[model samples]
Target: MRPGHDFIGVGVGAMVFDDDGRVFLARRGAAARNEAGLWEFPGGMVSFGETLAAAVVREFDEEYGMAVEVGALLGVSDHILPDEGQHWVSPSFAARWIGGTPAIREPGKCTAIGWFRVGALPEQLTQASRDTLTAYRKKGPA
Candidate 1:
């Protein structure tokens, strides 16, 4: 049995900020597990025994070939996608860029990647990411 479809999945995300404070985002590809075609805070499913913080850090490195320093928790989101028949508990965090240039390491999962000012983000966003952003905004500082 597969995750998400067979059982609820757990994922981790990061609102990684660059030196200029722009947040990094990735557009989901057709093969994305859910919420394809929408933009989101780059993240992925967590492996067994993996801490959420470590998952977020690994996600950035694996998905974009970048490094990030994980910080305070943003919030936990109940990502229920009825249309896609998938559900996930997503915990997101605030992180800082450590180094490395962003690159799409998984073309099947991500179509485009970029840094955007928080004020001007892509119009279409995944629910999990939207929730994370809302939580982050409410959080303000560390």
Candidate 2:
């Protein structure tokens, strides 16, 4: 049974910034689980018993080939993609890229990857990413 389809799922992500203060983002590809073609703060589903922070770290390592220093929680978002028939309760955090340059480690899940100043993000964004950005803006100066 699919986690988001069969029941509410838990996903985790991080807004990882480089020394230059640009956040990393990835465009979803055709094989993305949902919101294909939209850009998002890269992340993925949480494994059973994994801490949210650990999940965020693991996702960055596995999906972007980068290590991150997890910061405080950015916010929680209900990623209810009704049209796609998926629901996820996601907790996104603030993180700093500590090691390795970012790269698209999961080509099937991501079509493009880049770092951008928060103010100049791409127009099309995934629901969770939009929410994450909102929370980040509200936090301010961090």
Candidate 3:
């Protein structure tokens, strides 16, 4: 098997639902490299040697200043954006908040964070993130 042929980078996103079932989301900063100024699930690319679960937890803390107890794997999506020279295979997961509140932990990547009802997401969500949310809605939280 050719290694790099299917070696798309990995990413981890969290569907952090609150007591009332609202989900956490973040608006990408205007200075981000891709999909700037768009709402998206708070996450980032997994490091070269990182596990998907670990990456999810790390990203949650880094981006949102909160610790997450990751649960079931929600699903995976293979997204390719040739226009932006991006290709990633994202493994999303259902997570529960363990501690801390949403804060701008990583100012370079995220500008704002908020909780919204899953049924009523922001209109400016990133396409890939929106697709993930759609799948989550269809499957319901695990």
lDDT of candidate 2 at residue 105, scale 0 to 100: 81
Q: Which ten residues in a row have the lowest lDDT in candidate 3?
A: 1-10
Which pairs clash in model 2? none
lDDT of 1 by residue, 1-142 (tens): 7778899999889899998989999999988898889999988999999999899889999989998999999999999999999989999999999999899989999999999999999989999999988998898855
Q: How well does candidate 2 match the true structure, expressed as C-alpha RMSD?
A: 0.8
TM-score of each: 0.97, 0.97, 0.87
Name the 10 consecutive residues with the lowest summed lDDT in model 2. Answer: 133-142
What are the per-residue Cα lDDT tens digits for candidate 2 across 3-44? Answer: 999999998888889899999999999998899999999889
What does candidate 3 score in Cα RMSD to the true structure? 3.3
Tens digits of per-residue lDDT for model 3, 70-115:
8887777776767767677777888888788778977878888888
